[model samples]
Target: MQLLSPTATTYSELQNAYEHFNKVLFDNALPACLITLQREKRTCGYFSAQRWANVEGQFTDEIALNPAYFAVTPIVETMQTLVHEMVHLWQHHFGKPGRGRYHNDEWANKMESIGLMPSSTGQPGGKRTGDHMGDYAVEGGRFLMACQALLTAQFKLSWYDRFPAEEHVAHGQASYASQLSDPAAAISPAQANQALANVVKPTVKAARQSEDGTSLQAPNRSNRIKYTCPSCAQQVWGKPGLRLLCGGENCDSIPFV
Candidate 1:
């Protein structure tokens, strides 16, 4: 047997997660960025704008996840930190970013649109935007659907840092956080919505099965869900595991991909 390739197993998993989340949550609109493991004390993770460039002069933003807290926090919770930074990246490229490290209203709204609620304390009713902030996963939200899809596909980070950080936060609703992070509907539209809301039915997809050999149950939502308002062409993306329609004013068209 060949020895395992550590970097391939580790970093590549994060890269895959970034791409997967980009498609599922952001309508594949967010630009590609760097995913790095960092050891910053008391920091779960961070997003630095235009932090790196290749010899060819391509610049990409950087998202550094503190590996120290990986083992202390649930894996899904840790992934939540990754996504929190991703929201910063989203604002940096597509929306108005707050000055310095402050999280602005646009970023906060975007986070809510994606089913991640901003909070200063990482829980409900916490401040929505600030220099220091965290988020909790929303019930029956897009982020949960995305996470379920990833899990159904058997994607995971193969390696984790041995040392943990001092500051640890359980950033999502873990079952809520899971779809958004490691915890589970476990990530598709149906079961993810069902798991989060207990409404939609779950489906079975390609994957490793249970001990009895039955296929595992997953969410109903698939990847790359998009909707466009017919009258205004106002597009929106999400995977709520519910029937989607163009919700523009006077444009309630019930069509989608």
Candidate 2:
């Protein structure tokens, strides 16, 4: 916050956000990743695996956030995008990943475990796994708690796009509306509204992240679509509208119908 130039401040803020979430959400097990601010048309952010290497063959993954959406995107939504990509990074390292832009259930479940609900439609009942997905903070979720913790520790994102894109919908995140409906954790929508009174800066109204995720824009693709591999006859279910591949070993198969 002192004599640092604009470039330093902007990247530092994002890097700090990554570090904060890594500890609280991922237990700090994820290695450091190169963070960049590159804008992709209609894309909020993305995680590209092993995009960089040193002369010694040291490799590093890349996570790029779109600066174009910075000014217009809410702080929490920006956090969601970052974590969404981080989940991808995690899968690339540890779990079995679906090839070529396919989001597997493992990724979706991990997102849920960390407090971000994955949805192709960006809303409740949306497909949990797919290409080009949207996500929201979970109700009474660890992600929300982590956000509260990060803001409380006085983190700031100091830079943004000058010509921000037109925001289509206000992506919603939950405060404490847990799906379990435990009386101890449940809160009314009005209460959820008041939950972020001191969390988001520049002062914006907070919306409740509906149970399961947000429904602001993804196709409410059917929830019961099933696809089976033609070669191995390995049957798998997919959310309607999600493109998936047959993961059967050595089976050259087309995507799920």
Each model's TM-score? 0.64, 0.66
TM-score of 2: 0.66
lDDT of 2 at 17: 94
Tens-digit lDDT track of model 2 for 51-145: 89989999999998776545434466677788888888889998987767778899889999998888776657778877557876786799888
Clashes of each: 16, 6
> Which regions of candidate 1 are displaced past 4 Å?
1-4, 165-257
Candidate 2 residues lying further than 4 Å off, grouped into runs, are: 167-257
Q: What lDDT score goes with residue 139 in model 2?
A: 69
Write the residue-wise lDDT of candidate 1 on 1-257 in tens digits: 98659986788888888888888887889888888876654456788889899999999998887654454344555667777788888888887887777788998898898888887766577788777777777777787667667868987655544322111211111223433334243232211221222221122221222111000112233433333333454556665332355566675553321
Best by TM-score: 2
* Native-to-model Cα distance after best TM-score fit, residue 112 in candidate 1, in Å: 0.3
RMSD, one per candidate, in order: 17.0, 17.3
Top of the candidates by lDDT: 2
